[model samples]
Target chain A: MNAIAETVMLDSASTSVTNAVVMDCRIEKIFYGDFLAVRDSRVPIKKNKIIGFIGPSGCGKSTVLRSLNRMNDLIPIFRFEGKVTYHGQDIYDRKVDPVVVRRYIGMVFQQPNPFSMSIFDNVAFGLRLNRFKGDLSERVEQALRGAALWNEVKDKLKNSGLSLSGGQQQRLCIARAIATEPDMLLMDEPCSALDPIATRKVEELMLELKEKYTIAIVTHNMQQAMRVADTTAFFAVDISQGSRTGYLVEMGATRQIFEQPQQQLTREYVRGEFS
Target chain B: MNDSHLSAESILQAVAGDAPRNLQRAPLEIRTLKSGALTALTWVMAVLASIPLFSVIYMLLVEGGSRLDWEALTALPPSAFEAGGGFGNAIIGTLVMVGIATLISVPIGILASVYLAILDPNSKLAQTARFLAKVLTGFPSILAGVFVYATMVVTMKSYSALAGGMALAVLMLPTVILAAEQAMMMVPKKMKDAAFGMGCTRTQVIWNVVLPTGMPGILTGVMLAVAGAAGESAPLLFTALFSNYYLSSLTEPTASLSILIFNFSGMPYDNQIELAWAASLVLVLIVLVLNVVARFVGRQKF
Candidate 1:
């Protein structure tokens, strides 16, 4: 009777675990040294949803994005009170490894930080770091293809990543991030430094990627958020005692947030009535 | 009244036209003062630095001319002042000592530089080690020689080639450490960060990206250390103990050009004095050659 009960429990546990939420961050506060940066945030990230965080400058939208992958942990003085979970497991648990968390959630920085290495090597970097000893060339090609940069740089794999134009470098960075086959991607104003054409390319790429992986993007461009994000959250800046804090004003389906914002401030900001 | 207003309008337009052109002119006094001061300072600094260098070279070439014969190049160091001889043994011994010293110092210096440059800049141990390296760099050369003498020579009961080489190594270490560190520091941080972002471990980033990028600087540093090691006499004086004969084994004492210079400079004989000058000239020329070689190797347009 005990053996039969154990088998039944195992079957149910495995099925629920398969449908687990990818990321959940409940952050009460983010402090840099003694100054608060962001506050009172709770976000549940479902698989393959493109979530957008949009706000004005100094709003801590990027701060919240970085915290999801523990990228802000690199700063020596960065401190936060938060519970960030990945795949139903607490990511900040004492026994958890940061490297493993990063492996699952790749990030593209605002500036195009392509490796000084060749374009091919830049794409291959993440895969090699994870010790994926498969056909490196094929994987690099696939990543480049996914980023929509293969046609421009396919013939010049040996060329330096820095040799590319600004838009190309950004695409190369995207390719590098995706090369590791991460389950989720974080982009911090990825298209802000790009031209209109490049911005459209990146937007389209984000839309395409939502079919495979969950994505969270922090953007100041409200139009961009409207175009690509399925779910949209507005971050509002509040400062006290020279310390800045950002709180989420409202979050809902993108169409509803833009068309029928419930918050008066969100409506004003979205309608260009207030900065 | 209408005619007067039209006249005033034409006059105002003429003044406005000239105003922009007049405003474009540079202030003459400021430009003249800057050029004059720059010229005066350049000449003053150039002349001040050239005087000492000119005098030393003039003295070496004039006093040492007669003694720098082919015989001096071939003959061995004489045990007595009456017997005229050359610095062949000293030259060969100097070469051997410097070679061994280079062998010991270069690897350690380059590795330490790699650690300082490519490793965790945030690590407390690395920071403390850098501070210690700086302190060691300020330690006196004579002190280094004495330390080596007390440790290697006195304890071993004799000054061997090994002890001399060790003293030279000690003298070269600080220079090598500082130079190598600076060279490594010149490598751009972007390169290292890019390598890290790719998933390369700390060691891989250093070996593959950082070291190669900083290679030219490392070469220049090692060469500077080698050039410095060539003229060092104080550290080797008590440590290596000087020999008038050729050296073949690590256990035997070795004579170097600096020792030869010290001994010959004190002799009353005119030939010995000339020999000292000739030896000095040769050592300077060797140093010049090494620096030229280093510069040649390190020169990169980019």
Candidate 2:
């Protein structure tokens, strides 16, 4: 094992008794009907830390992030040959229900997909779906505050969720995800469509959210990884005889990955030499 | 002459002065003539298409206007050779039978469409069902009447409102299914993704998100089906036959506006012919009101 893997394994072992590893991906290969999409990937996600997955387009970072919550199961042709575990239990086990798994691990997509519903209803969607017993208004308020969207939307709670600006819609989606109080959150290029100011706001929200919930984000923006991520995993594409496959190249502390990458590909990627 | 040295305003003034004092407009090119001809042809085609509908309405209004009154709206029809009666019972019967048909067809049609668009889309069974539905839309209304005549009327041993309603329901099923399926298909796929990502089960996603978003469209389809069912006379002729009294039960013979219009228009009596014209006008008005209400309801926010 390399030094980064060794360090991650040590951390995993040290925190095993406490079950601090929120998710562990031991993905050997992912296939879309016999076409390889990702291969030979192993990543350990710790609790209450923001981990960034950075790579060029078509490197399978989003695919890998989606698999953590079993969102890829929706695709008819998608099949993966490895295990993804949540809190020491293999989520791919036959008895494990994906709906239940998703309840504990929420996701924010690339586009700001707010439902065609009232603002309050959007924030309260997951809570209502999971049959939350607490005061619904209070829980919605708490979630909105958690996402730093409370003040902006407090007066327009009854307005359509689609009526908000794109940035506010994304924040409402964040509020909706966190309202379920999931143990971990997965974000797939959450800020790619936002303006710079909105992107900064979302990045700041991610930093604040990491103090409570574990986060794994896929981003094409290297600077975004540098700013918000505590640890960064760099994925690279491998092309041989026309078929391109993606695999994890290196992962370590953000400073180490950006300032002193251990692998040649990582060095080249961070130096902007080549993707 | 020194165009390069002149400012833009001076050049514009000079060119304007040098331009022809009485400039003639350009003649129409062959392309413009062809396009204008095509536009006029389309307008003519549109008017020709509407001629039958407008003429029918105009004939109904002109011939029936003199006889239409409160008495005609509230009284039963007179005997073939006699006069001084109305088609009130037929109006009530039409409403009741169409209401029954709506209740029967809307649920089954909407459910089948849900299955086609959401549950098993692209499956061989779904494709076959959709193909058969499209074929059924083109199936003759007289064949629908014959179907009810064979199955329900023969089994019941009598012409009754129930049999008539069943026939109309059969005629309406394909339209409701096709329209509702289209509306359900238009529900954005991203909405489903968002729902699933929030930990909702498939059933919940369909019930809470899909159905509500598609409800207005489905309702509009249902209204259209109801209007179409109201205008069908062949099925009612085979099943309900005719009754001069108001509908008392589903198993009883019932009178409807279209059947009244059909039976009366062929008679030699002038009074019955006038009554037929009024009934035709009332039927057209009913259909017009239904379509207008559908548009109004469809415009409401879901």
Candidate 3:
């Protein structure tokens, strides 16, 4: 590592780690118009750690992530019986504001969704919406730099964000997400649509970001989990008893889960034995 | 056979050394026939549509030419055909009624659209409201005039410009709602999600993102409604009551150009008929300008 990398790591280490857990969701049940999506489940998210949720498509991985911030509330038919807490506060409490929770827990979607605006405006959008009164230009610059996008777009800040290449647009979305200084970043297959080189750059950004914020990522790519995750959770669909709800098969440190899984399903999944 | 194959191979090698060429090009005869048919059909339809429009405009200019004087356009309203006055009061009266109608319809229509686009997608009430708006759009204009006459004019003891404008507004409400709703629906869902994800409320998302994005469409809808109001003679005949003097208030009986068009066109006097033709030309011109403005606004991407 170079001097700048060393300095960033050192400064990050010096800051006392938060003992408070990031997300503690105990979902009793999740439903989509009378269809139970996820059965009873509990997950404890550690602070400042990268937790990867690896599962097959339609296994309710994205559904769980959306529930963490109450994003599913927008769908009128989406019902749930759950108790989710962040920093020990009940997130589903009637007084709690999902909008405020979403602001604090930002998300980057599967596809790059930079607003159809200038690159600078895309980064500054969340900040302006949240009514951040500080130096907005410097904040935007810092966010772009943090997202590893500042060098490529430094001189073209006024250009449309939509005009950027796909990889750059994803990074611009990351820049937009971090502009608000959220506590945790939830990324849903952020690199699934990118090329290998772009994926590598995003992976590097994620590793660099782990020192500062907690991240929960849902991915279909197992190698991605092996590469960037500190902890990994394996989910499997239960087709028996006419129940297709996804359940957490196993979870452990990335090395232990890959090397010695507790459940046969997890082992088989890790070795690509069954989907 | 071997000798023939060897000779073909030699020819192929010679051709490959330069460039390969297509042995079979498109049939020139078939392409020529198709192009000829298409070109003839295009010209025939173009001329067929253009002729009636040009001829009507030409005849209108010829028949209404003598009455297009400055005095005829600028002078006050005349009760008698011998007075030879202009339809100035009628023009002003038309403008004022349309303006009031636009003001009454725009806010209600846009609000209804916003509600339908944002709130009605998943709700049964919203679906019902959408159905009602669609049905209301196809309602007859004369029936609207009758309804307003029964409700407002009968209660107030007289038909007034306010009653006329109200009838027009009722006729325009469904159109304005439907057009504005379509505009609001064109706003990307991702934009709304981004706004809401930024800690903004649903109301804030509608106001800041959806409304601004749909601004040009809302303007076009309002313009169409106003223009459609310009040609409605049936609604105004019972409401405006054909005044001979200037309209000072909304509640007073007023004479609009459409009402005058209907009344003067029925008279025995030749002068009144000429005046009616001039007013018709002016009405058509006003509607034409409004449509042009709407088209220009619709072309803007924002």
Ten contiguous residues minimizing lDDT sum, candidate 3 chain A: A1-10
DockQ numbers for every candidate?
0.17, 0.50, 0.36
* lDDT: worst 10-residue window of model 2 chain A: A1-10
Candidate 1 residues B169-202, lDDT tens each? Answer: 8767767877777777876765554454444556
TM-score of chain A of 1: 0.91
The local lDDT score (0 to 100) that residue A89 gets in candidate 2 is 81
Better of 2 and 3 by lDDT: 2
Q: C-alpha displacement of B156 in model 2, angstroms?
A: 1.3
lDDT of 3 by residue, A1-275 (tens): 13323433554565456544567878888999978788767878887889999987777888888888888898889987889987667889999989878887888888887766689988998888777778999999999999999999999999988899989999999999888777788888999889999999999999998877889999889999999999888877877758688777787898899999998888889899877
Ranking by lDDT: 2, 3, 1
In model 1 chain A, which range of ten residues has the least summed lDDT? A1-10
Q: In candidate 1, list every pair of residues with a backbone clash.
A: none
At residue A180, give the lDDT of candidate 2: 76
Candidate 3 deviant stretches above 4 angstroms:
A1-15, A18-20, A115-121, A150-165, A195-201, B1-73, B78-85, B265-278, B291-302
Give per-residue CA lDDT, model 1, range A39-68, as digits (tens): 898887766789999887888898899888
Candidates ranked, most accurate by TM-score first: 2, 3, 1
Cα error, residue A116 of model 2, in Å, equals: 1.8
- Candidate 2 per-residue C-alpha lDDT over A161-203 given as tens digits, one digit per residue, 9 for 90 to 100: 9899889989999999998787789999999889999999999
Kindly report the fnat of each predicted structure, to 2 decimals: 0.11, 0.55, 0.36
Q: Return the clash pairs for model 3, or none.
A: none
Error of 1 at A185 (Å): 2.7
Best by DockQ: 2
